[model samples]
Target: MTATPRPGRTIALVSEHASPLAVLGGVDAGGQNVHVAHLAAALADHGHHVTVYTRQDAPHLPPRVALRPGVDVRHVPAGPPRHIPKDQLLPHMEQFGHFLADEWRHRPPDIIHSHFWMSGIAALAAARELGLPLVHTYHALGTVKRRHQRQEDTSPPDRIALEKAVGHGCDRIIATCRDEVRELAAMGIAADRTTIVPCGVDTTVFTPHGPAAPRPPRRHRLLQIGRLVKRKGAALSITALTALPGTELLIAGGPPPHQLHQDPEVRRLRETARRTGVADRVRFTGGLPRESIPALLRSADVVLCPADYEPFGIVPLEAMGCGTPVVATATGGHLDTVADPATGRLFTPGDPAALARAVTALLADPARRAACGAAGRRRVLTRYGWDQVAAATWDVYHDVLALHPSHPSRGRSEVTPGPAR
Candidate 1:
């Protein structure tokens, strides 16, 4: 007899702040948006029906939008239908949770997966009320942010406590890297409760074979592309530019060309370049067309990601996807992805000189850069593709579903949770 094919499960993804449809390169819109959108689409491609629930940021948005053949984007009416900074979104979690619980009560899904901490709060509540399986992925941990940003951290005061509750309450936690597992452990979560499913790159769009953007013939090019923010290390990269006289740094991402002059961070980075005496050598290419990213990545001799602290930074992976060598700080996910001296080089965070040294080394040796780029491409195809990520995530869903063979509404998960402080 032939073994019966397993039926696909319906899944709900809750992302309270990062709407899957938001344009990238915004102050708050970046990796999480990309992660949620791609994961939902990939799960749908895998024959599972998926629904992505996000805050209704615009009053004009329809209640439900068909994102793909098997995926739907549902707008949850929690707070005002306007842009609200994610750090200030915690007060709306109760309403968001109630809405989820009521919707699922009418039509339940097989799993509830949440992205970021605020979504975790809402998802945890809905899961508890409906006795549904919950999975959480904290794109960035509050403790780590506080440690790095200190007084600058804008998270709600109850963030850590609630994060703990969510970690303990959820059926499983999907961490993006090994460092996050350690961070979760420090919060009293056991390693068994968390699984690693990293943010993935779209390899088809980001391969090494694509045409590279034309560059300056005489000067070497360096690149750093993502949402232009202080913590992302644009300033550090600018500082490093002073040491490499023959190189030009391309700082891409921010408002469009006309609006770049008005952005505070852009102005700040410009001032940094000027003060470092590298203003002539630095260029700011405003938000680029998504289709042009692979070309931009290919044009760079070295991609710099010297973030103060990265929570599985996707830029390096994208750089790797384009067969570009990365020089990232050895912190957070960079430690996991950038295999030192192989795929790329790693330096200590916040050290501009060290960052410069790494970049200089990569620029000096063309063969080394090529070998690293090739290795980087191989690594991305093997480990960081969305299909692989989706399959790994599906395994987590299967394991959790197996743990709850009976209807979830009739019972809760039997796994013993670590104490939530």
Candidate 2:
């Protein structure tokens, strides 16, 4: 067990990967980046001093960026101050942990919340040295990944075991979905410390419109956004398009086209499309600026997310916020976010036939699609807004503090109380 925060205690967020300011055009900058960025800003809005430490991906960068009134991004030097693929960064956790330990020697955080496994290792190391209370969120559990990706698992075999250890060792584990809670329990994590918090969306940016420009007559636009990877189910989405005639699938992600042919996922997806006989209908737009995503969602008739595993499905939430109905796999956060037959539909994971049915049904019926899209917009406003998500997170922090007092889990030293709001 660990001590809770004292009154006006400052907190540190350890995300060895996923820099808040990094562009989301790479394999690493997917959901975790959005999760940490939004959570930190939201927590700051609630009057808690927050310092988010991420690997420095560039040289000559400021040590901190005041993201909001109280939230700041601290670019820590772990490896080279340049982009390093996340999988390759695991071996550098020791260096990351040491950097945090050094930083805490002068100014320690009251509570440490680490995101992902490597970050958790860094957090655990720093906490062990300073007696800081640690909470962890395994954005994508290795066990879950192995099960979904199976023979395709690129993660080291020890990844699952390491994740399991972290899940059990942390003072508390924030499981993004109830299913994950069950999975954690099965993996030997304490059931008492687990909290279910779904990833949130900016509903203000993604809302339904009055009569969307009538989608192309005789041709439906289906959008699938995210890193183009096997685990993300990009290949499955392309295959589903084969079931719907005159349906054009737009795949948005990956580096620029000039450099895309070298990326394995992009090349694989293109090959899959050709093999499935839908290559003509599939368009890999590569990575577009994040700001352009809403318009892309609004223009599409249906958003496809057939991901095999999602700790929390942000894409579906973003689509729903944009008044675009989603057809996602009934797994992970998708189970919690998308209501089958209501806001959107869910198909069995990895089942191209099931996905085809759901997508084809949505594409063929304009009235049903419109109704579902409207419902999705309403749901996001009521549940997934950043304000609401932040408030809930604050409650968790307070609860932890109230439950433990003597331990003073602020690591070895205490950070100077800075303005967080």
Candidate 3:
């Protein structure tokens, strides 16, 4: 048998908070974690040796676990060997960067790609010290948050400014949508340094004609998946369900219902449903296994996403892949993904009345729903599959490596260069 040459050497993925192995179906298992994990597996399939570094949240977690043939997870010791929320992980970036630097001292990876703000901070610091090429993907921008939230936003006061710095400092910014490129430019990130690479879905798993598992029989089922946060706009969907009689709204995210009562957002959602006289129609599924999400989507008549803002909403994409139509707000990435009158309907963000009207119209017409679902599945498979996303990301890595080769002191190639480069 002939030997196959390697493809541009090893690459490191830095994700401080979201571990690839962590169960999805929680408050934090929205987009970033899925993007990183799927992207790594896809990249590995393309013959790249990939190593994902995430903060170790449990002592029992192995130091390394193979995801695919060429992909591995590396649990780096940062703060405590226990779970810590994303909001509390900022102070440990310096330690994360130091650990990364030490890891690179002996077995250096060709390039480092970081996900989220704190990961970007740690990766940038480590890259600067090691003279390594760095690529960053900020799942959500702070500038956008401040613009959307104004005074009510509870994010750290300095998040906007710090995110701006990360965007400008990184070797290249991976904008998940064209809208994000505009947001980055507004925050002073050079347009030329930004590449638009949207997150992708696994079409093989989220197919249109698959046999969906049995779901509770209801007059009609409307699904909403993601965190129970103000930005997610789940409460708006719950309120809208009241106007559409006989429709069962299943919310799939967050902890169990008992634990949910402890959350202010969950309580607010319950209150909104009661005020709208739809509390009985809405059911919170709490958190379900990630493997079970596709089946859930397949059984839904319509998927609802009323997020106030999103860099790229993966829930709608997942629904689309499962041959399900969506009713999402025309904000941020939703405007790019959902084609009005084609794949699904779109309404103004924060307008429950408008959202209710859209959902009502979809529920009234079964043929229209079928047609839209077919179109949505075709759209995702054609343009937003994991293969396409992985290739695009690899291209970015190659471009960065071509621009910067060996360190000034090392004088040897850290990452293999193409013949011409």
Candidate 4:
């Protein structure tokens, strides 16, 4: 039902804060970084000339770097030429937009695919100026985050409104999960313009047959891998350790390993573990390298994803790809990927007792864990492969390009103000 993808088309990917080259599992660097990195590589493999435009986060780095054979990373100057928290980058979007507009004036891509809302703002400005088609993927929704985090949510006041505007204005919106489709509809994004494309895992890297990393000398190993933010529910994962006797928990993500002692959330989790009498059993490994993650996943008796909310968690898919059973919260993307009693166990979000019960159940049965792990691997191979995700995205690009063919007179020097929808 989709048109064949034309080769040699140039595509611009705009991600303002989450650079594809940034180290994964950092405070701002998590799923989006992995998603963009793999997606760009896969797209490049498919014969498209892909350029990823991200904010320049370091002073010493060059303006551009060849990320791969056909993919280029262009660092757009905005704000201070150094690292700044993603929440603080909203104020510099105007400068970011101007930079994008200037860049497009010289050499514009055939289509602009913006990731996250801030990137959408910049891309929208340039697209309007050049009459180029725009595709958007809001990796996470501000409205949902605000609802969940409430006072703790530090998102800019205009984020929700701006996200809604971008959702409605873009030519095509890629909803990374089925749950996001309903959320998009509620925010006034048209059903026809939105497409569901779940986040994928690298099957080649995450496999069951690989040599697993060495584990601590404990009866069982339970793993929790993600940022140490409160919303990620690392505390709950530590709490669950109290119920699973003879099992040691390995918390593998936060700031870099050397900087772990300074992270307040890590300190809080350590305190929580002490209070729960599991301090001796919980080990903090800090952040692991991407290359070491697959081995770590394979070493786990079970991988825990006890997040308060997740847009589309790549961790569950990665664990599944590694043939490791996941015990995840039953919310957001986890609902779509985690098959209850088949691939993994899911519990109500924020329930420490429920999380404990789920993990305890899995830890007690090796046969069930093996069965679930095998099923998960099969599910990932068939559905969540990066090749499949990139092919689907390519089809989307073809369709969007076909519908909105570029015109010779479209790129006239008209500096139109960005759309607020």
Candidate 2: C-alpha lDDT: 0.80
- Checking candidate 2 for backbone clashes, the offending pairs are 130-411, 130-412, 206-321
Name the weakest run of 10 consecutive residues (lDDT summed) in model 2.
411-420
Best by TM-score: 4
How far is each candidate from the true structure, as Cα RMSD in Å? 3.5, 5.6, 5.9, 2.8
- lDDT (10s digit) by residue, model 1, range 1-421: 1122245789999999998888788889989988999999888888889999999988899999998888899999988999988888888888898899999998999899999988988887788877788888999999999999899888777788778877877889999999999999999999999999889999998899979999999899999999888899999998988889899999888888899999999999888888889999988888877778889999999999988999999999999999999999999999889989999999999999999999989899999999999999999999999988988888888888778535544433322112222
lDDT of candidates 1 onward, in order: 0.88, 0.80, 0.83, 0.88
Q: Candidate 2 deviates by what RMSD?
A: 5.6
TM-scores for the candidates: 0.95, 0.90, 0.92, 0.96
Error of 1 at 122 (Å): 0.7
Q: Residue-wise lDDT of candidate 2 within 212-257, one digit each (tens)?
A: 4334567789999998766789898888878888889888887876
Q: Native-vs-model 1 lDDT?
A: 0.88
Reference-based TM-score, model 2:
0.90
Ranking by TM-score: 4, 1, 3, 2
Kindly give the number of clashing pairs for every candidate.
0, 3, 0, 0
TM-score of 1: 0.95
Scored by Cα lDDT, where does model 3 land? 0.83
Q: List residue ranges in candidate 2 displaced over 4 A.
A: 1-9, 209-218, 405-421
Query: Pairs clashing in candidate 1?
Result: none
